[model samples]
Target: TGDLLPPLVHLGAAAPSGLVRIPNSNPGTPETLLATSFNMHQVTRHKLTLAGASFRVATTPLLTCDDVDFHPTDILVDADGSLLVLDTGGWYKLCCPTSHLWKPDILGGIYRISRKGAPLIEDPRGQELAWRHVPVEELLRRLADPRPAVRHRAADQLVSQSQRTEEWLDDNFATRPPAVRLQLVWILTRVGSDNAVTCLRSLLEDDEPEIVTAALKGLSLLRDRGCLEAARKLLQHPDGAVRRNAAELCGRTADRSAIPDLLAALTRTSDRWEQHALTYALIEIADVSALKQNLTHQSASVRASVAWALQSVAPDQLQAETVLPWLTSETPLLQQTAQLLTAQRQDWETPLADWLQRQLAGGGSVSSSLLAVVQHFGQSEHVQRVVLAAAASDTLAASARAALIRGLGKSGRHPIPQDLTDTVVSLLETSHPELLQALLDWLRASERSAAFNRRIWPKLLAIAQDDHYSATIRLQALALGGEERPVLPKPLFEFVLEHLDAEQSVPEQLAAVAALREGTVSPLQRR
Candidate 1:
């Protein structure tokens, strides 16, 4: 035991483990010293030295049980010569693998030791008991105890009183058994809040499948926007399970951008169970084109998956004479499948658009499926019908208006077609702030002749005063006024100056300054 001193000193073992240092207050000199340690016999020793000569004291044996182990974790000695030792449990080595033996009596004991002259004085059991500080390992061992009561007590200590929660997580999160880490992720994420959100996010990329699942489930419980972003990034994860979880999260949020990534995942990954989960999520988000090719898969399950996805994409598009046979069977799955084939008419853009045009003519609102059809058939006559329908409905009006603005703005130096202008202006007159801004943008396009500005000045002035509009729109109006200059209002100059001097955005401010100078300085005069 005494030969252990050199190795112990080399390891700084004599310098108390888990000791807290308090600095001395005297100016220009080092301060008070307090050191504590717990010996292998479960005896705690504390030393306090002030101005150079101080007393040393220790606690008595913390445990009296026979055949007890002597691994202790912490020690502290008080001014009254009372000692405290935290008896941690012991470890055992087997031929196959090392194991642990948790001794409750050693961990539960507290002792007080004293020194009389040179020899030590010890009481196995003292009247006065030092505060018991149990090792966190012991508490965690209790969490794994067969007895429910012991597990509950240890859990309460870990969660409520001890500062060992971090220690528990650090110890277990990296190397513990899969099931243990999984449970820890759940508990930590629930009780940890934002603090735990990061830890769980890290576990999302963990190697173990069950650990990743547990982390994903924990993130679901968090419901944080950052967590959602993390999940979105995981849509590209190499692991199928991570990709599947990301798809599931997108379904829960109904985020549209996730559509493309989920589509890609469904096509590339072959895991049937995960594929099924992704298929279900795709259906919820109204995006099914991803599985379109799988409609002819030899496996019934794969074929069924494709069938459902296709039905969602263009149900009527499949209704044509040749493909309709697929849906003719009478089973519930096949009946729904047939309805989808009829909906398959949606697959071929022109027919679906023509169908949507007829539906519009008959006074029915365009279905979302039909709108999807319109997206594929960019220039069909249904475009004209959709324009007309949007001219009629309030919400559809802006989309109708945006399509027109984009189309005309893209058309360069052609004759100013009256029909295009009339359709645009009519839509623009009733358009929202976005539409008004888009129209002004089209009129001022350097690609188009400065000619359109002469026709649109009145509408431009009307939108400039629209304080409900965005600053970008307002700035655009100022630029249009400066560019056209057919008539410049006093407020236009003041607005430009205000933007030039006060706005922090450099581009807009520079544009405003240039516009203000250009409006005041006539080019003809400079020439």
Candidate 2:
């Protein structure tokens, strides 16, 4: 192994060790051998004789690593007589420094070596085939070649020789194998000429559903608005796959004119996947009114899909009259779906707030759904109601409280009322990490007046210096204090500096540094 040891020991040595004979059927050719040379980064080929083996330093290496750290390990001669050289690569120096143990680089790959004119006995599925000089007719025949490489190359070249090949493809369209015809349709799309669109349109009427689907895909790829009429016709096709592909293509076309056809298709199929495909197409076309019509669908699943589709397009179109009825549905899925849709719509604020007020007044426990409604669309008035619910309901779930806190934070888009601030500040005494984090987030997001900052700064300063609370909560408190200018008092400034100088975890030190920087205090100035 140490036969070719380099003089500098620390840099490592080339350990050329394992050897294997290459099996050859030709008696006339000299016997060949392969071996690994680690540090030199080459698979050293040799000539084998009955007496001994001699190294053959050919102009081209059997395999070589361009990168300096590659370590060649072993060699295998496949049945096809191709050499498969395994590279261990650099592991210890690059990855596992402490262990100093040899391990192969996870990213390393095998190197294949074969002599000129060597017949590859393995499956020729992806093997490269020459196609340049082959006649257009000959290339068409190669489309049926078992190897994908041959088929793909032939299709590419045939499309490049466009005029004659297109005519031949059109003439032989009915007589050719379905697979070959499909490949032709794909080729035409790549050609993307006006004639290709005509060819794809014709294939849309083919008897084979698979061929029609492929043709639809090709037409969609062309993305020509002219193809929209043909795609719209397939929406009525008996085959679900064809209709699905056609609907998807119409969406990709993004023609508002396809809205009526997409809506008509939605009424025909109860198939969830098909309905989903149609709903998405309608959404892409931005037909808000048509989508709102489907909100009244008899099937809850369909209504849910329509609701989800509406979530993206027209949240304003989501009426409380339509969605409130869904919340009362027997199905949980529908109820949850309605809640999500309501949460995303800003216009639902007044109605949803009224519903929550009624629910709380009736002595109902706060639900996450109510909180979601407020979180997304809550006003300052809605924020006060949520704070009252949180205070009154001692039995409130942690998740519900968290949701309420998030809603309160989101409501800070408007000026926070003094009552809301006092309510939030009193919760800090609970020292609950989630609530504290939520309060910090709310303070950061809120537009605090100078007076509000002056009032909150001392309370936040106590949280920042306290060791009883988690580093995360304390860091958040520090971050909240940093948001307003001139809020960091002189005492808090020295406390932050001391914390930065103290031996602390990476996160704690980072928090202290950030707080100091945001307060316009530089650590370098102290030096």
Candidate 3:
């Protein structure tokens, strides 16, 4: 029964039996192969050979059984010719670990061998084909045979051929049907020779989409310098698929000059697939200038892609500020683009603040996206300046105040500047109590002098006394002062002390007390 030891060979499922057959009969032994489950996990099985027939021993010296890179395609023969081991490439080939493996243009290859002196026939069910010793050249000749069987065998054999067959491929390209031509393109790419490069380049002007697709696939596989150049030029090809493929190829090339072509492709195309592919390619290049330039593209889709692309290119350059005003643009697409740009490059905060000021004057509402962008610029002096400016505005000013307070609190740079304190104090006097609390958090976060907080403390306390003070603001004010309400100017401090004793809800009274206490504790003291 052909050295039968194990009754079944597991394909997808687990092999439970620990015994297998070994070919080649060794002297004094029946010559059986043993398959032992390596661990209880049942995922890996170890193979052992029988020599004199007492027990099994691993034949490989100085290495653990696990050191081997086992695959189903590999066949191991024992020294005594007693064992024939088979590891099919099916698992490895299907899972495709080597698919992305880095191999030089020429050294890597996969081949099929047929020992029957004829090519291996495909399994009728269309699952897989394997055999012993069939040369790829023999298969190529059969591709032109009059018989359909001869052609199918030849076509299938090309699947495992090395990428070095580009010259042979070019010579044969004209005779093959469009379908086989496409297959040849794929085969030639794996060959990765200069001839393959030329073939793909020639296909750039092809009228058929399949031909162009094959060429693109070949170029992508070759990925040589010439391929990169050809792909860059293809960005402007009359066909959309060519243009789209060119963008995709550029992403793989990672060449900087490809950036301009990718950007052009992004702007010139309106089809969503082309736009999406081009956007990703541009982002992969990490080209900041290209992103900024497209911020003004005529298509809203292109404009949106510009925003997505900016995240890939860090806005480290000085010119990023030039695009800051787009953050306040009425067009949502441009506004989204500007927001992402500002978030990455804090250096743009200065110009972004300026833009917001202009927008406020133009009667624009502080959109959430703009607020998010400003907050991401982080709590720097520039950000603080904008926050304070926003706090000082009358309409749509609450959003700005909220952004400033958040920036100051989370910015790791607690204690806003004394100048900021001066602005906050002035705004509190005329603004709603809600606005005052927002300013107070920023004031407390800033490590300003006692003198700075002291100067503003009186004004904040007086706001606490106004019966109109909401419970939330009243509590914030009390926290600022505490039990030992310090004496201050009669108008502000006296107002606070009276309010602290006023009959109110506990939360409101506490707020007044807190504000009184905060007045004494300088930002530095609180820290």
Candidate 4:
């Protein structure tokens, strides 16, 4: 009853419609929907790179609303994979007032499409079986059912019996297939009882590494101190997956004793996946005193990792003097991470501009991230010089040049220096779109001066007069030329006013409107 609005004369949907193509009157309104499905992945394999994801691709779609105005508000999948579609794009005016001027509410359809040759599935909601009173053995067998709804129902009932769950695990867990065994560990982990924890501890000795890794993952979430020793032992497991899971478990438990093993693992593997887990564990534990003691390690990579972990633990203790060795190093990760760490100190902003200038003067290799640091935080006379130097260079990359100019535009803390006016004017010949846009943004941000009128005005007038440039750029040029000047250039106002006709494109006309709003007009010059 709350959805009401006065009648809209320009309703985009046509009446007498089951489904019709919606008109463009209300364009670009996004639709939101609800969906029903569970994670369909089996627990048997550990190689699925996207952990805890439930997405699957089917070779053929169950139904498609192609060539129709079809937007469904909700979708449901039945036990046999049949799809129920609720299409409401036709007559349901989402929030339009419940008006009597015209009725369009009775217009959507509910559709169901089923697989042709598949066997029928009985709905569990029918409750033919007394689920709680069902025999324990039958419930265990149903855990292997093909339908997710059935398997979930069985687990929901079996989770209530801790003694029975433990007894079944001691007697029959090994003989079941790996998939079923993994499922038992998952179900017990949900109970959060003594028997559940004990059952998980027993499986840590299982012969299969994947089974052991799965147990480690569950225990990590439980975060029991009793399993800390058990998790610590797998830190050097021959399998990388086991090591990763073990590192994560130690991190979650916050065991101070596991720091040594975590460090050893970090220095041993060059694999980024292993490095990520080990680094995450160290940061989670956050023992800065211990992390600092490892700085003397012989491997530069290990030292760099420790330095990063240390700074992350205590951001205030960072000294750029100690870190410059890494910021200037050949190792890409160390240099990039060091840039992020130094950028935290806003007092160091001018120093960043100095560093860039020194690099430029020496003709040394400049990392892209270091350049970004200078551009993002730097706002000084040195920054103006850096932008001017980068702009005129033919050897510098286009993106690097653009970043410097953008930094100048973003410098609100410090005044835009007048020294850059000539360099900004010389950019008139830049053919790169990104550099040209950055220059325009800088011009718009800078405070106008006498130098702006004498140097920048001429180039802007040329751009406005030359037809080679797009109309949008030309109109922008015309607007920028007279924006701060008390009197609009006679030639500039005359040319634009003459072309304000139906023959110009809509964008040109709109840009002309913005220019007219900024510039002054003389009563004597009106024609």
The top-ranked prediction according to TM-score is 4
Name the candidate, 3 or 4, with the larger TM-score value: 4
lDDT agreement with native, every candidate = 0.50, 0.66, 0.55, 0.63
Off by over 4 Å in 1: 1-138, 143-172, 227-243, 284-527
lDDT for each residue of candidate 1 in 1-527, tens digit (9 for 90 to 100): 00011111122343244443332212122222233332223232233321111122332332333433544445554433444555444542232111144434444444444454633324322223222476766665544443333444555556564345665554435665454465566567646645567778778777775566567766765654566666767766665656666667776665666655665665565555456666666676665444555456544444555555555655653344333433334333433444444443445445544544454454334344344333333343345445444544554445554554444344342334333444544554654766675565555542333455445556656666677776567667656654555535666656766776663587668666555553334454334
Candidate 3 residue-wise lDDT at 494? 49
RMSD of candidate 1 to true structure, Å: 24.5
Q: Of models 1 and 2, which has the larger lDDT?
A: 2
lDDT of 4 at 194: 75
How do the residues 1-527 of candidate 4 rate in per-residue lDDT, one tens digit apiece? 00122221221332312211111111112212223111110001111122211111212223344423444545565555565666554455444332223335545566776667978777633256567667777877877766666776778777876556665655646676665666777787887677777778877877766677778888988997788888888887777777888888888888889988888877777656566677778778888888777766766656666766776677555455666545666677667656666655565556666666666564434466555555554555666777678666865677767766777777654555677677777886677767776776676676666556566777776777777777777777766764554456677676566557778888778778767776556786554
Predicted model with the maximum lDDT: 2
**What tens-digit string does per-residue lDDT give for candidate 3 at 116-165?**
44443344322233433656655665554444444555565565554435
Give lDDT: candidate 3, residue 251.
75
TM-scores for every candidate against the unseen true structure: 0.31, 0.49, 0.50, 0.61
Clashing pairs in 2: none
